[model samples]
Target: MCMPMTGARRSTSFLLALTTAAGASLLTGCGVLPGITGGSREPLTVMTWAPDGTQATNMPGMPATAVAFSRWVNDNGGIDGHRLKVLTCNEQNTNIGAGNCARRAVKEGAVAVVGSYSQFGSAFMPPLEAAGIPFIGGYGISGEEFTSTDSYPVNGGQAALLAGNGRQLARDCERVALVRPDTIDGDDLPPLINSGLTEGSRHEVADIRAADDAGDYSSVAAQALERAGAGPGVPARIGRSAARQQARKGCVTAVLGERTETFLDSFRRVETADQKVRISSVVGSVGQALIDSTGGKEGPFEGAYVTGWYPESGDPRWDAMRRVVDKYAFGDNRIDTDDAGVQTTWIAYTVLKQAVESLDKDSVSTRELAGRLDHGQPVTTGGLTPALRWDFASMLASADFPRVVNRSVTYQVVRQGRLVAQRKGFVNVGPTLENARTSG
Candidate 1:
């Protein structure tokens, strides 16, 4: 005597998947360069990623921020009387591009490098380390890069974020599924995934490669649903599958997606092809392009749950950040495009700035910077809660293996195909890291 499953039921299951999976991410914007009123001959340079060359053209905000940051340092009598010279590179999808950018930063005598962008963060690391330059920003928290003394990661470690996500899921859902890239930027999640689950929570995983060449989520969805006891199309099953699929794929579902719209197109086909299988995800799953391209039309992604990181700045934080962005960066109209990126970048810059200013001249060396970071300082940019600290060494202090704490966890849902904040509070689970290994 089970009731019929509907899209609503499916949606819930999908959200459970996203929230239950590992990791947290906060987007931040570019930092402003200081305006030096009068300065010494020495110039301090900062480098960042301008992949689309939009900083030069479309998004003038990024460069403006860089300029303002430089100008601020100069106006503040310059960093120890050294004028700042900011350099930005459009490191499009090529390592060579990133390498070139890094080389430029090094050649220009950059005391510290910031904002190299994603995987490029590591790409720039070796050079900065070799040059004995202190690097502070550029997101993505890979464990390998975290080991470097020359680099200070403002962003939380990926291992901790994922482990936190897993722990949260273990508490929230009986059956949880993981859908993520096969080649993650940092640490592999197999161990983190294992650590997050409780004794009896069911687990399923989908290894989506970088190219996303495969146009299917059915096998993954089917596997997860089967394990979740949703294979029979009962009311619970329908909801479970829908929710699980949505969580893992976002709006893409089990369908393939060459582009965001392609996901919607394929999603419709999948659902139409089979009405019983529900597919859902967090709101941000469906790309903004799809949302706009479809002119806000309802599609498979209409009611997915989007769980992502956000600062605790409240509404006022966003406003203050916006002013910082608008005043400093140019053509930042798309600030709304990726709020998390903006916030993260800002946080990273502010942390580095504070750290740099706070350093006693003797502690300017790379080793000193790394040492000082151990005290676990709290950072609050734009009033975001969840104070971040550095403890990778301690987290890895175990005799046999590394142990980590899932410091904080948060959740957001996709309403009207947009990612919106849900209840955001960290669960203080003693989540620990297990089985660490270098990826081949």
Candidate 2:
């Protein structure tokens, strides 16, 4: 007793089938919803925010990477069968904007805020702390991230980099000069850099401050070169003549964030063949993309010294992260695997995943997740970062950064326009930090 097949009925049936498949894909692709078959009753919600489309210091990739991580993990049955949701916000590089993002997380019942970036930690950290939510793996831009009890930083913040950079430059350059932004946050940079320089028995760094966002850095560049003991009139090597006595090898390190490139451009223009001063910066200021853009082997960054939290972009340890980006975030230009923000986001999510998986319950609350992290669960980042655990003993003894658990940095140098490993492995800057704490 089958009805005769009609063209109209066939079209309707096909449409219904397509709709069903689309619904299933949406549920399983990025996140499974509560009450969906095989989904846990309690869903996990998290937020990731960064300045986007702002005048200065934007990190849109941090949030974008969060989205991609959600999609990839959900596709593979989600994190421990619990539905995972990511809420992203734009901080707009303002205090009010950062506060707004933090308030939104509180309103939305986010269990955690992971891998975010903001210089206004004063505005943001309060809300997360009040709500008893943990902040994990922030981009290390704000000082409150280190002092807040609820924060679990994966890497030592900017303090570690300046110190590490000083240490790296100390080996070869007898005189080192630092050019950094002129801002409230920038005030702390000089002391940290000096700590490392003095640790290596080198003279303290000459602090040179400049506008954070300037169209020209000619004056600044000239001043830096002059102070670093690099000049066109002096010979590259020490000579017997009194005039050549000023030829002491020098280096200038800049930490102007995005404007580092602009400063370097001006520095190159002012540079003379007789000047053998080396250029230096930390990872966030210089990376593979910048080097490639400047023309590989012929780039201005060639022979420049760089320090970073992770390995060089070409290292084999990053193979697993590369595969994830390829499988999930392919062609998504916002999520650059080489980007430090994106890499931090990936590692932050890995910690969250491990935290959730460790609990044996079908439903989880923010307190439960935070408690798991608080009890010192070791998180493995596939060798991206050192094994991370946050116990009382693990906290750094430093006054400003007591919550920092990982104080290691890698030394890298630009060779033929590519960032290569300058040191074999992570350089332990813990002693320098402790020394700085005691001395300061």
Candidate 3:
């Protein structure tokens, strides 16, 4: 018979049992159990989060695209025969909500968080970093997206687009009016646009601030048009001839996020036929979806100049993505092929898949996945971006955004209700951003 344990022995045994149970519980909470889940042949879990049904901004398509991508990949034998499991969360466009989503990703043991949209990067990135999870292809709304170590953004984000737009418009417009939100984020826009204009030997833009959630923008539009020197009473059929009349034409570029459509609605109502102001915006603020929702050919965006991070939706490079949507996401109205958010999600998953394939392993953890990416391997997005490598050499010299690897933007024009390439190649804005950083 075993002798009865004494006081110290019994306490030590009880403490050991308590610690063991706690360790198991912790692993379970993190969604990592060797044989039970995340096994060699089990599914690889990831997450995508975006704001939905919000008062200010919404990006339901990001998560919707992630779900569709999981289905498409699973049908195709998944990433090296391992099914991809995607968890989605609605950030609700708030700081607390963004934090909650990041926490959920950690608790659910997401290997990576891919192709999500949120302005509250400050709230979300810390949790993701603490959990050692990589953040891939975040819609570049917040400054934190560029600064965070874990973030791997696919596009040059708004920085490249605004600077590129300034370069494009500088070639034509005599005066440029910049209409942006009256927030902290808006403070950075003027300098960026100015950097490009300064590079092009053009005058700086007339800065106009507007409320982000304002229902009426007629006054703001009127102010922008006036500042742009878009005097009323020009003929409606100005045509390309307006391009030649450089002295009379001024460009109005709006960087407001979702409220851009509302602002345009008010702008059209106040804008006269004579005003030859060329309306301009980045892709996220104005795209094919908005053009279709507003009248197509007769929409406010017609003849507008737009800047984007990728090739047009009809580009042959997107053939594979289109095929996936056609086969897997049929009748899924939420997944718009042209929406930049949806496109970003596709490209992000492509990066994730490549990383997983490179691993060539049966089981993967968040640490291992992030390690592979941080090792400086370049990811090719089939011409969507230059082979993306986040090594020190790939990073820009900008003091504010050292991790901006892709500095290319495409210039597009709205014609016949479609966004077509105005210039048939990518324009590198790395130099402009560098200039801005040094000057700032």
Candidate 4:
């Protein structure tokens, strides 16, 4: 027969069992107990860098848009239940600053850099490649953005825009004069424009180079007008008659960043009634904001032809982006609803969200994120861009820009102080870009 234990001994045994059960619960909460549930989710980290308050090409809206997007996402349950941590850097429009921003992103463990603007791609891309971080939705100012294996550009950069502009002008103008910055970066503009003009069976443009930051462009403007052989100024009715007499109407296309406005200012002052010169430009070099600031319908850009990567800012497709700016931006002046840099940032984050959701695990690293994008995932941007895919099969065949997947641009014109679509659809410049690569 077994004897019963004392009451004090029974109490001590019961207390020991309770303590062991509590220890197991604590371990599971801390992720020490694996195989039952996945580890605790880690927040996703991203970096966005742009130049603000710089003497040349300031893109303050890019980083500002990135911050606003993070807030909007976090407020609405974040991407796949993982909190987004956006670290912003001001590149200060210097090569050194761009490299430093890349180094910081690597040191802080950012999986990707999205929707940023930096002309110093050569300086920054190396650091990101070394860390295996994907660069997505960049401003596409640098040729490296199109060439880097690590870069997933959302748009076709300047190459496509310039080529498309050439095609647009070819239909209307007999002679085209391209006024571009005289810099190492601007060297690539002529060949790309020539390719498009050639495809349209038009003669090559008269390529004129000017200082990017010149205080005045009177001489350059006068020279471009003279080369185009514009006639003397006359009344509107008389000008139309004079234009018909001329064998070819002249078109002047300016691609100087920021200084395009100043160039136009000088151009208008020297313009004669008989000149009948039509001004044309790419979208980044001219926009609604510039038109409004310069004088709307009366502005020098009136009747200008422009090529852009997306639909007009007033289109209904941008309604979703405008709502985010309305709510989370809280009237922040830097975040303009129509700014291209801001639009680019919004699209970049959309890509990031889609990429993160495709992951099997809640927690991801730089390598895993980049690998997912490289594996031929198609990301849709609600009609903001063609479905973006970075696989080799989806990329353009150009040897110089093997990574460029979007070769589409829209033709637009300034009318009644608003940018309206001249054509209802996108113009394909892939053939022109391919020809450029092979001809060289």
lDDT (Cα) of model 2 = 0.81
RMSD per model, one decimal? 18.3, 7.1, 8.7, 7.6
Decreasing lDDT order of the candidates: 3, 4, 2, 1
Model 3 misses residue 95 by how many Å?
0.4
lDDT at residue 320 of model 2 (Cα atoms): 76
Cα deviation in Å at residue 13, candidate 1?
75
Model 3 off-target regions past 4 Å? 1-39, 236-248, 437-440
Residue by residue across 71-111, what tens digits does model 2's lDDT show? 88777767787678999999998999999999999999999
Task: Compose the digit string of candidate 4's lDDT tens values, residues 1-440.
Answer: 22333599756654563479864454445532233222245778999999988766788888888888998887766777677899999999889999999999999999899999988888999999998899999988888898888999998988898888988888777678899988777888888887787765456888899998788999999988987667555556643334433433788899987788889998988877767687889977888899899888766666789999998898899999999989998888998777778888899999999998889567888888888888846999998889889987888888777777988899999887788899987888888888774222
Model 3, 1-440: lDDT tens per residue?
22344699856754664479874554445533333323235579999999988767788888988888998877666786578999999999889999999999999989999999998888999999998899999988878788888988888888888888888787777789999989777888888888887765457889999998899999999999989988446454664335324334688999888899999989988877667578889988888888888877666677788989999887899889888888877678888888889999999999999988888778888877877787847998999988987777888898877778999999998888888999898999999888874222
- Model 4 per-residue lDDT at 238: 49
Model 4 reaches what TM-score against the true structure? 0.88
The numbered model that scores best in lDDT is 3
Clashing pairs for predicted structure model 4, backbone only: 232-274, 233-273, 233-274, 234-273, 234-274
Relative to the unseen true structure, what is the C-alpha lDDT of residue 89 in candidate 4, on a scale of 0 to 100?
Answer: 98
Q: Show pairs that collide, candidate 3.
A: 233-274, 234-274
Using TM-score, rank the candidates from best to worst. Answer: 4, 2, 3, 1
